[model samples]
Target: MAIKEGLRPGGRSARVQDAIHSAVRALLQEQERSTVTVPQIAARAGVTPSTIYRRWGDLAALLADVALARMRPDSEPAETGSLRSDIRAWAEQYLDEMSSEPGRNMMRDVQASATPGYCVAIIGAQLQTILDRHPHEAAPSVDRLINLVVAPVVFRILFSAAALEVDELHRLIDIALRLD
Candidate 1:
């Protein structure tokens, strides 16, 4: 959804957004995604169908918006003493999540949106946070981390019909850190 400039996020707008998101999440859990419709979401969200159409243009966009929200990192990367250890931990977790069935589904849904790199930016920020923790050690740029680790992991999960093993993820991390 395109954000409206100057709109306060804590009023009727925020409440409606939250309600709509919650309604979508609940409906997805209860029914097949193909069965979900604008009217259904509107009724469940306590809003008019026009509201959703106006804000999201259609159901696909709304679902994509919801998927983006879910893909965002909910916590900081794990804190380990060394940069390599921290990156390894983060990469392993990333591989596990993005390789899961639901995770792959979320990635597919999020790809439907106009701003696909939004999720990448979120991941890059998280990687940078881990890199920032170890100032004394040389670290790869966040973009490098994503290119060397995230990109390959995502490719394997979505295209290869298999997840990267921990050993493979470690090798990717080593390659990423080797640039330093």
Candidate 2:
């Protein structure tokens, strides 16, 4: 159980974080979420279980971090000039990510974990970035925007039988923007 180099309390090495995150994603690809364990992740990551525990606290926290990292927009939100178009683009990308199996799994873990606010905070930051670009119209608060745009998509993802339709998402954006 050789711990990776650069182990420090409260100061994680980027290399170690990358390795752990990569290991989690790879294992999740082949294993059930419930079956994945700290030792398994440590083995895959080439670090000791203690390293993971020191860094992430527990399996759920590690999974939540992995999922949140995956969920983050790879690029900046598309700036379509109008607030409505921007919101639509952001919401669409968000919904697409959340609709995936891994995304759903991650969301479940995040929802169940003690650090649920991390997910919401990430989303709020992304939306805030978009809102910051165009301050012409008064932008809604992040909480309001989440309720208007994200809540419904999450509701459908959790409870609805069918996948959320593109048109339905567009309608949601419309409703959020008060365009209809």
Highest lDDT: give the candidate number.
Answer: 1
Instruction: Compose the digit string of candidate 1's lDDT tens values, residues 6-65.
Output: 779888888888899999999988998889998999999999999999988888889888
TM-score of each: 0.94, 0.83
What local lDDT does model 1 show for residue 7?
75
Question: Model 2: how far is 143 from its true place, Å?
Answer: 2.4
Instruction: Name the regions of candidate 2 deviating beyond 4 angstroms.
Output: 1-12
Error of 2 at 31 (Å): 2.8
lDDT of candidate 2 at residue 48, scale 0 to 100: 99
Work out how many backbone clashes candidate 1 has: 0
Please give the CA lDDT of all the candidate structures.
0.86, 0.80
List model 2 lDDT by residue over 1-180, tens digit each: 123456673465777888999998898889887899999999998999998998777787787778767777787889988887898888888788788877678778777667647768788899899888987886677787888779888888877876588898887666666633
